[model samples]
Target: MDQNSARQMFENGAFLVVLDAPTGIEFGIDLDTWETGPLFKGLKMIPPGIHYIHYSVVNNDKQAGIQSGFLHSFVSKEVVVRRWCAETEQLYPSDHVSAEDVERIRMGIRDLDKGLGAYPLGSGPNDSYARWQKLTGYITPAMLAQLLPPNGEFSSATGSVYEDEEMEEAQKALHHATAEPPAALLDTTDRFNFTHSDIRRSFPANAPPEDIRKYSRDKSWLLKTLLSSRWHDNPQDLLGELQLAFVIIFVGQNFSGLEHWKFLMHLTLCCAEALEDRVLVSRLFVPLVRVLCVQLAECPQEFAASVLEQDNFIAVVLETLVLNVYECSADEMRTIMEKEIGGLRKLLEERFSWTLATGRQLQADADAEDGEYAPQVIHLD
Candidate 1:
């Protein structure tokens, strides 16, 4: 936005990040970091919304930095504080300042601004703020608390068994999923060694009897069933868990985070009505499909049971592409999406008995070519 607009937006309150350490430790906000001398303080005018603060310990050995990050939300003119810990090589948050301190900082912001660098609003260091908002708009404070726990450490609360071995297993699973599963089932380790156990542990166990029957009948049914059921009154309650899973996997550097993304992808793709909306389609659909293409390829059997259920996964995706994508997307976006969708369909057909094209034909016939997609019958047994 223009300077006047920025001034009006920022005039309310600012977020403060202060490093009390003596200057050796490295620090950064979002994607950019300090390469020079000690940046003891940073102050900036922030738009009211959720923002991310990612930082890592600077490696003196000329290698990659140790990255860890967190998310925060700001209301209008709010003051947020974080102090750097040299020994731990991490940031710890401080409570909101008293009224006297707020006045003092506001009055002295001029001199303070001189010492501190401005948090990049739009351009230089971190322009990925828009993407961040898109990915995390559904995340609420209660959701964050549930996912992050008290200390903001994912591994601790979840008892994550993700290790190098698990990573290797994940790699193996990806290769297997991308390729065809062998005729003979290999050792149990090949199937159960990845982070699936950790992910399954976190799933809601006390689903309704019918939902439980659906889950027992097909493990893939568990996700949609959980997604449809509410733990409380809120429709969006499951989103918090999904958000935590995202933060852990994406920013928290945990491999198990993909489980959350997978569940989210299923829910999003199932929303055929929502896909019809131009704004939601442009913002969410393509990105989600892009992720889903890779994921579905990586773990086809993970959703194979779900595919056998009432909703045909492949048909919904294709229908979304054929109907919704062209109208909402530009030529370039449209081309990339068609290519990705084609790849996903090809992968499913080549590797499994059910052909995606057949599903599409069935769905088209069921819809009477009216644009609404329907599922084709499948006999997985």
Candidate 2:
């Protein structure tokens, strides 16, 4: 009813914007022979919003001697507003809610609340349960209860699809389980990747709470396999194998280029340092890692990597630190007679020196004429 509420509702809604090739740019190039345009199109991220914008153009003929080619571009914008039933239905401001839909919703919500549940979705790839998820949103045991046959009962949704008691017994009898449990069914698109597929297991916005422990368990199988590998083996023979595994992992995981590079860098850095003497040596591993990290920092855009599996951005920072310290610990610093602690201290000093040099170089390279932030100032009069 109020202006503030209207504005808030509008901002929270979604929008669909379509961009088309521009057409008909004219000129007074005598006899109207001037062209539509030349190539120059890009995106500018406007404040807080996701936009799917496309850039395209039509050129009847490309220039051979700067005498041909025309360009055109255009965009159409629209919004998707989530309006209230009363306003859209044109009912009175105080019109009461419908009793039947309310009852249906109440029963649905109650059924979904059970700790465990199962829907006899279809036997097909996308069954009734999958449809239910798209419509209702949350996963819970209670909803399963409501969906059971007239004489059936409720139970906590637990274990694998076959491990749950009711569902298991029902399975033996050749019947579908009515157990309603909150679960995000796996999408066919993400089954291959260990990480992304888990994203589908979300409860609908208001679905019941179903125990998701098992469904999410499969997500870690690949990670467990990698961690079990012999990280402390002979570096001369094993580093190559481990690094190959890492490359595959980095490519498979989704994120950004920077992310994967950083993760690979961090894990490799650890493996290098951990096995640094008998089986491996930090001195050798450090240099290889430095090259990778330096390359990662220079790249733009997201990279693919398991580093995202690590909390926050630790993988990125860790790799950068590893590269920084390894540069100093490589040769002259690889002295013996020195305790392990002393080597670590020297490596740290090297990292600090690198940081100082890098900062100084960046500042020195700034353009004074352009009034960059690094411009030196003498304030005293």
Candidate 3:
């Protein structure tokens, strides 16, 4: 972006470490790494304890723009935000908070929970944020749904663990907060009992039914995927969860069942109203490739309007579908996999190597960056 937006990123608690990547090096240092020496010449004035790290440089050349990171770290980490658009402030957001303010904010959190601001999930009122804390251990990029107003409003009490009555009361409060309208509510009356064999049923009469059946019946595949779904409260309806788990299971490493994930994803979208655990729904998308399907699944008008807004999730989603899926076509598949095919079968198999690959191996002809940290690199190390 511009110099203004860059400053905004620094102010927003981006852990903006200035790696000493000065231009014109015979052999360059990874500016993204820890600066072991006094490269900043004291201009960076780093504080001693719990200080938010950052650096400023007028590189004058093209060594700017951290590829796609300004927005990613903005959304990922607990970065501070100055959101101030004033010219000078835009020029220097690092000046937004002083040493005194930093200490005050840290101590304020200490005061909130006697040194722990975040209460255990399900402990506080069942507001959106509380559900988020419950779903994921801590709020990260996906847990934005957990943000709630401070106490004295619709907050749930997060009292001591030993207080049984308080805990019960907290539970009650959370249920109310998480409650939804009738249509949005799931059919809790009838428990769905699904079997691994039940998922083996026909898949469109004209398709490869036998091959699909083989993958579904693979118990080893079913079990591995089942581990994530085992915690269902109503164990009786465990089958329905299992059927959904099939999307991840049947696909396995080869990703044969990608079409199934696409079907399930669209089904989730048809019933666009969430299960009061939007953050859980979001974090299940830790496999970055699912980003697009998840966004369409959210189905918010305002959100759709802001889809063009720069967020790292959107960028990675585009890269996965547009770039990687195209690469898969070299194997002579006529129709390339569409974004509509959910569960991101290709991304899951390729991104994390989710298969028991024995003799088979993935080898790049030349040096290639591919991994979680791959997208972040701008210059070669």
Candidate 4:
């Protein structure tokens, strides 16, 4: 940052005060991380916006434990305080501390300035702050409240076991017959309020058979339903949720986060009919393409190799989206669509060797072969 910018941030940026955190633990805010030192308090001069604060506990051997984090929206010159719980080995709001003590700490912040680190705000495209801003551009405070857990905490170790309502009738009956203890039934860990979607149940029960079949095949109706019910017809909110899910997966390293991301990809990419809505095409897909580009470019190689192998779920969805847009859009819209899609195609090919054109051609060949298969009648008839 330039001197003027640095001075502005120093005068106005928010503060994070972490109290009694152990030395050598991995601590991070946004994209920057550090191994804590003896005097480590927290970050200083953080830009006023949404940021992910995360950490991993370290063992005696210095190996890190499961990552955990939460999103916080900071304001100018605000001080947010958190204390380490030695028994639980986690960070929690410093509610138990007396107000006077906190006030004293706030008053003495300048004395502890040397213990704090400045937010990483380098002036470049690939800088930590810039990339983080791109990743979270659409995320709003309202979206965060709707999707995050009630306590605003996220941990890789936190997960939900099957609830009785979600269990099969047969399983419930068996459990009752065996008289399993309630404690053994499910873990008490909290889950994020991700919008629920099931492909099998995408179509409405009251729809006619033909309409149901059409809805199942097209998924446009499902997208509309979710837009109305879950996102309040705001496409940007849906995109915001997508950004949140990916951030959770990428930063928290949580498996449930990955599941949420996949469901959203299916919901957004499978809707060919949605492309007809100019508002959706411009407001959603335009930024959606940019979001996916950054995510795929920054995605870890192990994740690509393991979770999304060659011809994986993303490739299939991208193929469907490309074909649908080409077949459904008008001539004028194709230019903008092609530009965004072309950039995505180039990135995929360069990074993962995923050729969408080849995939589309192969799918066509397979469909043609299926069409050629028929039952024949001979002279016996």
Using lDDT as the measure, the top candidate is 4
The TM-scores of all predictions, comma-separated, are 0.53, 0.23, 0.20, 0.89
- Write the number of the candidate with greater lDDT, choosing between 1 and 3: 1
Candidate 1 clash figure, as a count: 1
Q: Write the per-residue lDDT of candidate 1 for residues 1-381, one digit (tens) a residue.
A: 687866675576456646463354444454345642554565577657655565555567745465555556667767665556667765665542355655666566656555565555565432655545445656676555544534342331132324434555766787788885434333322111211233233324677777554434223343334434533423345444455455555555455555444545454554433444455445555555554443344334644554322255455545544443344336555555566557766776775544555434554564785554445669998
Ranked by lDDT from best down, the candidates are: 4, 1, 2, 3
Kindly report which residue stretches of model 3 are placed more than 4 angstroms away from their true locations once superposed.
Answer: 11-13, 16-31, 39-101, 104-381
Better of 1 and 2 by TM-score: 1
Which 10 residues in a row give candidate 1 its minimum summed lDDT?
Answer: 187-196
Candidate 3 worst ten-residue window by lDDT: 147-156
Tens-digit lDDT track of model 3 for 1-381? 355753443333222222222322111011122222323211111111121112222235724221111111133224232222323212123354566655554344223222111111122555433332222222222112111112101101211112333355666777788883223222222111222222333233344766456443322233223324543432222322323222122211112122333333332222211212333233332222233333233224443334322243333333333333333333322122333233444443454332311111222311254644366747877
Instruction: Give the TM-score (vs. native) of candidate 4.
Output: 0.89
Question: Which candidate would rank higher by lDDT, 1 or 2?
Answer: 1
Those runs of model 2 whose alpha carbons end farther than 4 Å from true positions after fitting are: 1-179, 188-263, 270-275, 282-284, 297-381
How many steric overlaps are in each model, in order?
1, 34, 10, 0
